[model samples]
Target: MTDTAPSESTAPQHDALLADLTTIRVGGPAHTLLRPATEQELIVTMRDVWQRGDEWLLIGGGSNMVISDEGFDGTVIHIATRGIQLVSQTDTTLSLRVQAGESWDGLVAKLVSRGWAGLEALSGIPGSVGAAPIQNIGAYGQEVASVLDGIDFLDYDNSEFVHLTTAELELGYRNSVIKEGRAGVVLAVYFTLTASPESTVQYQQLATALGVNIGDGVPVQQVRDTVLALRASKAMVLDPNEPDSASCGSFFTNPIVPEHIARALPADAPRWVVDDEPVADVVVPLGETPAPPPPPKPRLVKLSAAWLIENSGVNKGFRLPGSRAAVSTKHSLAIVNRTGADAAEIAELARYIGACVLSRYGIHLQPEPVAVGVELA
Candidate 1:
């Protein structure tokens, strides 16, 4: 892979408006756009952009981002390449290598169609394979972290490609080293999936939808369809005709807080205790000896952002005075572009909602999307 000019064979139309490129549809224009069609081209293009000291943004399906109305003043690299290959296979597991730009849900659909069982519960997510591991994307109790094998990424500062194992990425719930800006641009990703034809049903909502109990197994395609239906109901799927779908799927992540903080919320508030580690109590017979009690458990809890927002007095479809952006009619977690709103309008609405939640619950809500000059303050 030798360095060269950005390949025109795959470049997006010059200076495409950020609003047009992104799902949120509220940003301004990008100064320059380059879409690389191959991994080598992506590396060379990014290297050239970096060497020139020009600010650059890497975008895939643009589902989880909010750009400024003033637009980016530098180069924007739009990953457009696509490929998926079965890289390795074992008796019980299969490894598939996919380029950065492959659609996330599309990949899941393809895998499920083939009777692969690791990604069925994540069926309706919108984004790219490269972007999935950055946030450790998850849904319905299934996360990209569980299936991720490794990633081929470029180290811009060193102008070299590096292969990173899953452990090195430090994947946690809705986060990873890449999300923290430690890793460079992702060129490709590898996923290891089970050979079984049955998919795991770990989320209660999904299990209920599928008429099954948690921990039960179902056909992978059935799981995928059920997940997709659940997502579409909340306007989570990207559909141009659906006004509520013009926003990023979820504006804020479900807040993870200490157990005490979670306990302070209303009794009916949606909260789940997440155990960071498991400790089995060891019992010793009285005649023999006494074993010391296990160390105190770490108490962490996940709170629903939607619940917090609604409890804070912002109802679904709520909006600030004279604002074009509003909460989605079908989901309180989304901040939709209700009326061709600009980035500022959306940012203002987000701040208002956040303030409301903070004032009422004493807990600040943080946005999940990557903002480029779009201030939530």
Candidate 2:
């Protein structure tokens, strides 16, 4: 597609505060803001910004982003396109192609209502479908990677639209190629879901809430309701009435460390094995039989960030003496804008919590949200 500038009649919003768009409500004004309401408009607007060589930013649901108080100095394109099409279906399974701008939780709700199981455990996640693959968003022991089939991507380098398979996306623990500096935009996401009425309860907390044991099966709707309840209790779900929900859900991701590093932490620290080295298959001559592979090495352990923060002497609801930013009273992982706090204050709280965790555990905590014109240092 050819790149062209938007007409004067279609000029973007000028001096729009990013705080109005983002969930955290802490950023300054954007020099220019464009809300593309369709796939074609989104592509055209992005191409125009690129061709003009103007600095640009893309926002979806704006749930997982933190912008500086000084604000963005360039164009901010908000993805507002929405649609959900059934790509294919069988008696037992179905593939869905969802627009990038579709609300993630909304989609889960619809899927559960239809008795399509797969993403019930991810209910109450606040963000757009496009942001899901970028963050590999997950909760209650189920990740986007588990059901993702592929994505229709717009490559920034060539301005070409291409399809990327799940393997090509390289989704990992809250990470993917798009998050790893790959310059591209996800236009749509593909997911394969089952037409099952029940889903397996894998997370301990979720199971306990549902009065079931881990590995037990429960109705998909029940799982969604229970997961939503769990998220609301932690203040992870976005609710206008809940002041604590004004912050980004889980500001810090659980850190995955090598087995030895995890061993150094206190025995009481919550951790789970996330990955392990795979044993390579032995090769032998055509006439000879291959011997068995060696045992796998110690696996990588994922440590709980909330536990690390609390144990580091930074308790829930803790805040700087003069700052309006504070740790969420309901969950230590989140830093909330207690009252009209600026981006700097929020960043300060995050840095302090990270430093405290590093000092106590010797493992640095990584911020989960995308920081724009803001430094955690």
In model 1, which range of ten residues has the least summed lDDT? 6-15
> Candidate 1 regions off by >4 Å?
1-6, 10-14, 280-297
Cα displacement (Å) at residue 149, model 2: 1.1
Model 1 deviation from native, Cα RMSD in Å: 2.6
TM-scores for all predictions? 0.94, 0.94
> Can you write out model 1's per-residue Cα lDDT over 1-377, one digit (the tens) per residue?
56666556655455689888889997788889887888888888888778888888988999999999988988988887789988999889899899999999899988889888888988889989999989899999888889899898898678788999999889998899888877469989999999888987899999999999999989999999988898899999998788889988999999999999999998999999887676766777779877667678769999999999998999999888888899999999999996888999999989998999999989989898999998874
The TM-score that candidate 2 achieves is: 0.94
Alpha-carbon shift of residue 272 in model 2 (angstroms): 0.8
Q: Rate the local accuracy (lDDT) of all candidates.
A: 0.88, 0.91
